[model samples]
Target: MQSTRQNSQQMDESDFYTNCRAVYLTMFKSSLENITSKEQLCTVLQQAGRNPSQKTLNKYWGPKTSKLNFDDFCEILRKEKPTGRSELMQAFREIDVNGDGFITHSELYKVLTSKGERMTREEVKAIISVADTNSDGKLDYKEFCKLFMSTTEVCQKRALERMEADNKMRRQQFGSHSEGFSKSSLSHTANPSLGTNQQAEMDVTPRKGEGKSSMRPSSARSRRASVSSTISMGASGGSKTGKLLMPKSVQDWHHTALKGCFFLEEDGEISSHQYRLDVPQTSTVFLTIKPMNLSQVEEKPSSWMSVDAMFFIVKDHEDLDDMRVVCFTELREKEKFGWKGELSSGVYYILPFTTGCRLKKKKKNIKEQAQLVCRGEGGKLALTKEFRAALSDIFEVIDLDGNGLLSLEEYNFFEQRTSGEKCDEEAWAVCKENFDTKKNELTRQGFMDLNLMEAIDRNGDPCDLWVTLESMGFNRALEMVEACPFILDAHSEECKLRLKAVNLKQSSKVLDTAICKSVMAKGEAKVMKGSESVTIYTYKNDFRITSVIANKSNQKVTIHVNSEQSKNCLSSRGISMFAVEVPPRSNVVCQHVLPINERQEWIYNCTESLVA
Candidate 1:
């Protein structure tokens, strides 16, 4: 029996070798890349039911831990899509601890801790709590998977919030000192009737700790005491060492005080906000004030201050840029901060500020006028200079060979370094074959070459492009598209249309858009509501005027254009601007020219009447 088993194993090994050679020849039609091992290749053959010896497999695939050939197997599976989501789920369940439909928080913690997570008990508990959305004492498997899948989003939001809070605190502390000078100067200006001599005397001298009263002179100099206003030397008037008189209003203000500052527009009035300052001067002078909280309807005190007015004494022209000045709109509480006598409120920005130098507005054609000058779509993006500088700083990291455009090989190396995943050389080679070989180098044009819309446009023919980015995951590629100039900040009709095409073409799996195109209608569509009108258009000439579609259950009809048309085109049977005046159920179709891609495909779009 032992001899027979040995013979059977030998026979299986021979069969596997023959099958592998055949598959390689049929696919690459060339010799495989340099190889010192055959283990993974043998495993594939065995998995395909062609038997092979363990020794033979090891020779082809190297050590099991190498993962080089395993990556190739995965690459083959991806191209074939041999198994779907259900199979992947089953594989995932093999490692899952909980028997419940999903993985659990405790199970994850156990696995990660066993894997050597460098965290403390409390830290682990905190992280788990955040993931356990159901708050049923533990995280369900679905929740656990969600947490793992969106790790990038989770970490980004938390980091952003923490940085914003830290910046806010720093600005408040620093601004207090710098803002004091301006507040004092503004106060003097507001009450200018007090005579010039008094103003001159006020500017007499600067002393240490000039703002905070705690740093004043000692009481031993009482003999030199003069008028009460001369009490700058010490707590009491001069060095008299006498008890100081205090007003009830001042005491009330201090007791209810929430220490902070606010900014106001140059032409804005602070009276509506309600609080008043008796001594709104530089430093630590007491302010006799009243609540501006809406609940306190009194008219005497205004609550806010202008940023310029408060900081005029200390600020220069440069400080005006990239500065965020906030005003304390609410009073402080033991546990939470809120407005005095109001339901709930806190500090907010008084001035709209950016984090870096602002850009001067660009003059453009009248037809290309942007709606908003700053931070608006198609408008000059905020801090363009800063963004460019940052990209310059990190460019070297991505440009491994410093040749500028990242070659497929160089990009694969980058992916492994940044994503902890290795590329499947076979799959990558398959994808590379689809690119224009004449280009030779992977330039921006080469990347855009993969864009289905671009492919259709260049060929002047419409067919679904099915190229894939092997090694680079769908999410990573999506990020690159988002940052690209053609996609980011695009708002015009043409740009928006192109953006949609890019999005549809870059989808992870092949999409079914034939249905979307078949349903399109041709010609201009007119819609009318009580007082509104709208226009509808289709991408291609194939669409016929179909009966008006209206009043379907809650799912309002939206216009669809041929996947190839500019993304933002109007469509027949869709709610474009022309339908604004058309009433739903009042069916009407008009014949007119409609734009189409090179393929002559279009989809129906509803008019505003559908919305009505």
Candidate 2:
């Protein structure tokens, strides 16, 4: 077997700190700012893909050498005896790049991903979630320490504490002439030809794909190699170490178009949609249903089916009626209904069905449908370390509750969101039987296992896995090897409905829109206020009830949903109490209010609140 560990040439203190200086000189607002202390330099080194140990970093930028925050920083270092509170308080300030009292998720994510042992995005999110007492997505100094705690127990049992003994010992040693750790290196002869040490090589693997973030310092130099600096920490070499060390995945956006197709059984004409996927190997298949009109004959503007359609990714059979559904999309009002499941290359059918005979959706509403599209991406997300890391991020993204356990209901939401398939009672039971679970909730391991099972069932052909990781909003821009994304528009026997790409769109102010007029036309609204940022719009009718929650803020918001107000109402997930997370300025169908009996007045009085 090949060696799994990666090896790279190591750098000495001069190279390491100079590379650190390279990052500091580049990403900062001004190129002149020097790396005067460990705190400032540590964060920069993270962006540069160098994670030195405490002993190592301290050895390079020691207590005596650092000019941290002038006297304030040095006072703590000099005394080495600041109280635990003071030490942590100081640490928080250094991490706060903009000097903002709170540390934002993006900032924290950047620090964690670049500096430490590679972490799944989920791990970092969990850390802040503990200290984010206000549920505002950012951490204040106190919350930061509380989340970091293990000793004082002032906050929850998870509180972090610095030892009083350690602080006192460091303070008592403020004696002899403590010299700069870098003094020897600084005194060495200066080299004028290294040309700024800009090309220093680190182990970060660079790819042409979308990096984690797109936020680049406009003034930063282009990608170069061999980063080196003189004894003086003047950065000269340019090392563009995958510049996307920031918080966001800017490449995950979609190029969307409005697509239309007819159901298989309409007016007994037997028209259906089928696409061939003759993959030379196993692959991934995912698709989304952002919106579909329920209108027949004349397309009514702004309408969702009275009940959503059943979509399927099925084995393509010569007879449409005999097709075997590989996956199912349950009937629900989920606006972001999609799939990200693995598939072997073969012909398949993308089937959509409702109970109605013949139905027609006008082109007028097609643009609106396309504009409200669930995002589609992940053309090649193979199961590499990157894929594993991506899955960890996905797990955290779906873990609406910070409890670290994925309740069956939460897992169900994940299922429906990723594959439009609900994790029914039997499926949930099977999960508990096979994978790790806690208190009937899927642990992070189980969540991973569930996804792993999909690919594993196919004997682990990773081409499929790559496609599976490509997009969270699984929808129909699917393709095979060397295939460009296209939509097949066809007309059956005698149906007059036409299919065309009505428009091309990017973003939608979908959440900004007021109560969907179509939703109002079908049922009465049940208003549930979670926060100023999130609004849960519930609509009730005879058979079932549905709710859509929208976030108005720039931060990802989690709102707990409670159906207790409805004496006998249960959500489609079968749980009356599960939280839903709404991304910033986005809306999703959060709940499907199912009724125990069809004859009763389906009282869907659901309530919600921001998770704090």
Candidate 3:
């Protein structure tokens, strides 16, 4: 068989551009004037047996150069044709079986052994390791071409060496046999007719396409030559040593071979039942958990469908482990979906079906719904009698000073003692809003009217809090209070203290407006007393407290700032110092920061009380 080097040399000598130029000119009818646009040029190229995408055309005839003359067109063809690589790509595509643009171990193994070659698993792995640069255990077009080109070079060199060796051996044997026959006396002793017949046999040569003559040697040398011929035939017939390596199974190719399709049923009932869709042997299937009501059924699918849940099912391949079913929840509209995790072999009622989407209208008021759900069919008395009595006892203890009405200071003291930390001022504010009466204090009756304990019990249930929050327009504070009743008391106490310290009346029409502006602007507000002002900035997870203390008296004042929260508040400079000195007629600013969960009560006192 001819070596790859020889074949390449032949191809080089065959005037490739001459043939391409002729084809191009023929497509344009011997003129290039009418080929004005890139689309026109692509058509001409395709008609001439060249396949190119729009991107390929743009690389040569770019957007800047709209028109191409004959000379430039021919020049591009010569420079960008990729003759050898194109042939290699064609062969690769043929072996790629599934046409996934990647050559998998199975496809490679099948193609290599199709011509009677056997490959082991380790050998296949070695071949893949060489070209699988991404470590994905598959060869893309570029990698496959690189592997094939290298193998071809090696095969050519080996074939050339074998041919040269065979030629040398033939020469040595011919000379030795000729010398021995010339010196032998057997020819003289034999009959002249017999000698003539032997000479005639020696002079006759085998015809083309016929087997080697019977006169050839039947020794080790001849057997080696036969084996070399077989190897050459295998190489010439599109077989490569690298192709014999096959991966263990199809799983190795799944990362590239697997594809998914998602489907949603309109007005489908949500149920806790297993649904099955027949999957293709080598494909994956994904189903979106969207349950649409009749009102939402528009002529065109809206992008706002609640895709809060989804699941995937993969067909079994080779091993049972390849078969997977996974479900995911807490998804949002237009959020990219993926498998949550591997699920066991059982029926799962995913999302909309179990949530009864079709049976109910789209929720318009989430907070109201959350409240109703939390109340349940058991009504407001969801708590047991013992739990209710325990709650009443707790409330009585918080009503400090024996006033029947719980003042903000009393509530704050109660929370500080119970939690063993400083009060969460934000939690206190929320409690005040929900349970405080017209007097700006939480009365026993007002506290019970809120049903704080029952709300907490309902919020702790296994219902989806994310969906509830979404319906409620994401009222995080309300959600937090409902989930934890202790926050209500804390917030209420904080509110009472703020109003009492500021001496603001609850009956004032401007009270709600003033509090709303400060709280709504940044979820926090600053309270000033005497010559000292404190602003607390509340975040989702932490709080920043900024304090300014001014000394109006004609003497220096020493201010002490201490955090009652569990987490020690750090100053802006990262120090734990709480005491700072202020000069006469001057002010001092001190800032403290801590995480929300670590917060307790905070106290600020001067060496001498300042007059308001």
RMSD of each: 35.8, 29.2, 40.3
Candidate 1 residue-wise lDDT, 1-612, digit = tens:
988886565455334332333333222212222122454455444333233445544543432223332224332323332223455356447656556666556665666566543455676788777866777765555555555546534543454344335434543443344334432332211111101010000000001111223221221111111111000011111222222223334332323221111211111101111111222222222212221121124653222210111100101112322222222211211112121111112221111111010111112334431111124365423323332233332233333334556555544544443344555767556556765433344544344444433434544322211112211111111111101100011111111111111111111101101111111222222322211112232222121122222221111122211111123332321212121111222211221222223123334333222210
- The lDDT of each candidate is 0.28, 0.40, 0.35
Ranking by lDDT: 2, 3, 1
| Lowest-sum lDDT 10-residue window in model 1 | 198-207
* Count of clashing residue pairs in every prediction: 63, 26, 18
| CA shift of 596, model 3, Å | 99
Off by over 4 Å in 3: 1-88, 91-127, 133-138, 180-612
Any idea what lDDT model 3 has?
0.35
Candidate 3: deviation at residue 343, Å? 97
Please write out the lDDT profile of model 2 over residues 202-244, one tens digit for every residue: 1111111222432322111112211111111111112122111
**Root mean square deviation (Cα) for candidate 1:** 35.8
Candidate 2's C-alpha runs over 4 A off are 1-156, 159-495, 498-517, 520-534, 553-556, 565-568, 599-601
Better of 1 and 2 by lDDT: 2
